[model samples]
Target: MTTQIKMTEPQMLQQLLKQGFEHLNQGQIREAADCCQRAIHIKPDLVPAHFLVGLVALEGQDRKTAFQAFNSVTTLQKNHPAAWAQIAKLCMSDGQINLADNALKQALKYPNKDPMVHDLLGTVLSKMGEHKNARKCFQEAVTLQPNHPPYMLNYANNLIYQGELEESESVLEDIIRIQPNSPQAHWSFSGAQKATNTKHIETMQSLVSEKNIHPRSLPFYFYAMGKEYEDLQEWDKAFESFSKGAKARRETVEFDEAHEVATFKHIEDTFTKEWFEQDQKGHSSDAPIFVLGQPRTGTTLVERIITSHSQVHSAGELQQFGLAIRRLSNHQDPRRFSPQLFTEALKLDPQKIGGLYLQTTEKLSGGKPRFVDKLPQNYLMIPLILKALPNAKIVHLTRNPMDACFASYKQLFADAYLHSYDQAEMARHHARYRHLMDVWRERFPGQFFDISYEATTSDLEPNARALIDFLELPWEDTCLHFHEQKTAVSTASSIQVREPAHTRSIGRWKHYEQQLSTMMSTLHEQGVPIDN
Candidate 1:
């Protein structure tokens, strides 16, 4: 037989690119990324190679690499709408909404039929406080790709945000019809609080126990089942479902309790009362009304009320201050409150850090005099916040420990909520949170207004008025009807906040008190006062 002729470089590149796409589709992310890199080496200007590399990098969670690769695609082809679309997505994730908007506009300027670009543009607009424009983008995306579940879901979310609940429910049902096996579609519909269909619930329950289904989908399936059980008032079954959901979620992320302990210890030691008493200058802005607490502790409820006031803007869960800490620490970890970082944050110029946060938020506020930053974990950064924005009002939300922690445990966050995965860990974190709050009270006397969920829900108007007075806002009846406000809440409380304030959530932890024994023991060991 004649000797086999070696394939040419172009042939090799084509073969590699095809292999990369195949591997990418098959969930072999590293292998796909490697193939793309090899293709890029053989043909540096290959647009498909660069695009695949960006996609693989994004899937592998290397956003920096993805940004560069996608940017490269644009350089090679100026009218590349797909590249611009990805650039917009990456920019949004990096908290660059303005840039994302510009990128999306560029993407739409081209003759592109891609629904994802329109979908992403919708999300960017929503985050920028452009609800009407966002809805339009979502509508266009859904029209272009009627069968795509994600497009339908995004459109449904926008519809819900605009108080079109019936329309939103219809779209969600359409999603279930199109993709009957889609766990996310079923899970999303459960949040509408209208899951009366026994067939759908049974289908989701069966999906949860199916070993053939995706492992990542298990968390959502379990949580969806939990929601159904809770709706039916099967308390024990509900708790069991929620526990499985939390366990499945925890398996996906590595959260070290030791690391968390070390981090909190660092915060306690670094930001003392004596530290605040020092002659330090900070950026002064009455614009910031900080609502700080553990997650699910009525921070969102209070935010809804506060933002309903005409003068206040709702900048949901800002990461700017946390970003500032990361800037000082020189650590890339988005969670910047660790021992390795806090000391460095303490050493930085407070005014500069404070100024950056205000500037970033003001752009999002649309000239509103006051804006709410309802980042619950900002409790850990209270000292940093106080030292940076001295004139800002702080609203500390307190909930019954069991209610707060258990509520958090039941949620499957879009991102990592490491502490919420385990009850004992959650209790430990709550104790640390309470300790820090006490420290804040001791150091900055009369500077904080503590709002209790139980107290507020028990007597709504009186506490609502107190909260308004604390913000130095003139009383408006709008605050009393926060649910009537058109602005959509993007939190776990999204559905709950749509209804009038009620005490149904009060003493909710009693339903599963037996299951929470480990958490209760941990809280007691840490000197937290459990209720009678």
Candidate 2:
């Protein structure tokens, strides 16, 4: 028979926290959360326990648990800046920017001078399209901790987002000088500049091989290495680097292929053409001009061009639509909001839905006649959008199928978009996306203006003129000079759009044909309309 040993209260709490962290690191979210909750039971006022649980819940996409845990930490420790910062982070991730802003302000009032708080605040401000204020926050963070690479990197990113590419390049150079081993700095720098020579290729290759580098950092460095190789026209090497980067990212990020497939099927089944043909009335606000398509398409370029007009403002990918849908369904997590829930929302007053959309966007409009919503993923909500904003102008952008898929595969997304890591998954998703668009087109004839990326780039003047005509607005010279505008572009195409219109990305996927064979075959199998 074994004898039972009794442990002290403090010892038990410490052991619980340690076990929770071990589970969390191993990706056992449920076990980690249980351990953390047990630790919290042992000591109700334990800040670390609450915070750890919050992080675990966040990883598992349980927004309610994470929000409550973080909120509890703030309540338990009134002056806890870190807790407030975590709250702000969760809010931002949920697309609650105003709440995040308020939380960041509270975090700043605390005595702790962690540059991280200020850095995060800067990111929030950027998300709100407040670039000037964001620049100030970034500058303050860099001032408070000049040697911190993350703060400096954020400062550099803010600069780049606001079209200050040269200054951003300077800041990135300083970061590289200060911390030579920082893969993030190198990766961001590559995005900001095009290389003429392969001088840094050998150094990047060696750094990627170094076992001392952090696992999280390798993906960024690998992508940067791929960009360099692509610039040099070394196709095989570029494919190798990009493949490694995508694989590295897939290891840690959680994406559900099954959920994605189900979501698409739910959408198709629920929003039948007959459902749209039913009598429904929406708020008569034609103030929104939605520009949507798959990522890496010309959506950003189109939005910039349209918002360049005097009567239009750019809202820069607002989450208002997603948030509105969540509120309507009373859902905790937007991703988990089921098709049945959406069907239930369809029975609600369309005016209320449309009103919420306008109220959320109008504040950002500053009384402009039109505001452009450049959310690419908004394509998924096309049916709901048409029902809510019947008078809204929808501008749908398209690109060559292979180029679009390849472009998405090459970049490292900050949040979700799990299918981007695998070529066939990406292609299949694109097929579904295209099919949905086709359904929408049949449901609402003469409702959307289609703009092909290749066609627009091939004949900029005429195509832009036609788009302006579609909007019932006269063309302005400034529309052609959209890149010269001072407004911030928060998308991945920020750097590329700052340059003049070009055909460089037109057939980008052709260079990696061998590597993307799986994608090409999948697209063909799924009937994704590959003209090029």
Candidate 3:
């Protein structure tokens, strides 16, 4: 008879940790957590157990638990790359970008590197406006896994920001040759360069017509088709494709109009002259200049012009100010900004909020005297910004309502501006935004500067001069030649902003006026003037 030997406690702990990792790989979150807990029970300071626990929490979308568990792993083994990487991801999701940057740096220092970690670090670095470093990280990711579609796609996308459009298209074509089923690759390919013929357009069209296409990928395919058609001046075809794409996208998102309405209404009702005037002293740093408005409304154009000045740098679309508001208000809701969160924020001391915001953005400010925080949605947080950083210059961008709505409608956003997919929803949302702005102007007259997109494009030199004057900066001819700036623009307007300002997009919306009847009618119903 063969004797059965019982495993020792150390061996048993090893078995549990191994089992936890296997379960995690198999997508068994609860089983993985249980195994991790059992391992921790035997050895409380077990780094592997804590790391496994963090992984489980991440899979379950419990960022708080994941952060705590990862912190424990770091405490046990400070040089643990995986743990630090996980912590960086959690911090990024929390809008603690500087902390995320630090954690990512730590993760990158250790030899036990993950390709995904490299890709993530690249994204974080790109967001921080470190284009060259970000490109290296992305290229390294592809090196780690050659011809890997995801990694290759990231590298190709980054090339666009670097203004290497031909190279980007070449890489995208290689991806298509490798993986024919990639809707995202096709979409990126379409937007990489202006289409002069029906080369890739036919390929995308065929992909969409395939019966086996994924439901989730329909929007990407359709949007690609829409863009190419628009480039070819096929307005009817473009409208149809855009409409189908919008419909498909709208179905995938869970957008609630009530939440937005309530949030805007709260801002209008609560944040008034009296509210801000009471206990008004804030952080004294005039380092932050905000360029904000609705997305696709020339915020990037304005930002490029301002940042072209020697005294200023672009902190691309920072979440710091809004995050400061959320943190100071003890916000728990993941909706970013809600009526409840806004209500809670009313009790905050503006100085503390201002201090917190500056602390978070200090790294991104570089050595420049002023840095533009070009987050378009920060328009909603204007009152908080003024109350906290009174000296912060806020430039609001205005575009023709039809052009603005149409611009957003045709674009495929990764995650934001949820109301843009549907014509009626976008129109109504713009109306609400306009209403809030009017109240803000009434409460804080001449506190913020407004620049019209049409006027700026039509009279680039004079408008650029006025913009510079408003910021109290010395006149620089470089500001007028903003398109000549070598800094990478990582916004949707990356391509357009890199070229000389033009009025081509001004009357372009008129081509689709018949197709966008719902948008026009909705704007009329909401009382938004359509100047074009």
The TM-score leader among the candidates is 1
lDDT of each: 0.83, 0.84, 0.88
TM-score list, all predictions: 0.93, 0.86, 0.92
Q: Determine the backbone clash count of candidate 3.
A: 0
Candidate 2 structure quality by residue, lDDT tens digits, 456-519: 8888888899999998887898888887888888888888888778898899888888888999
Between prediction 1 and prediction 2, the one with superior TM-score is: 1
Summarize candidate 3's per-residue lDDT along 148-263 as a digit string, tens digits: 99989989989988788899999999999999989999998888889898877788888888898878899998999999999999999999999999999998997899988988
Off by over 4 Å in 1: 1-16, 97-102, 108-111, 196-198, 334-336
lDDT of 2 at 223: 92
What is the lDDT for 29 in model 3? 92
For model 1, the local distance difference test gives 0.83
How far is 188's C-alpha from truth in model 2 (Å)? 0.7
Question: How close to the true structure is residue 83 of candidate 2, measured as C-alpha lDDT?
Answer: 74
Backbone collision count in every prediction? 0, 0, 0
- In the range 165-187, model 1's lDDT, one tens digit per residue, is 78888998898888877777777
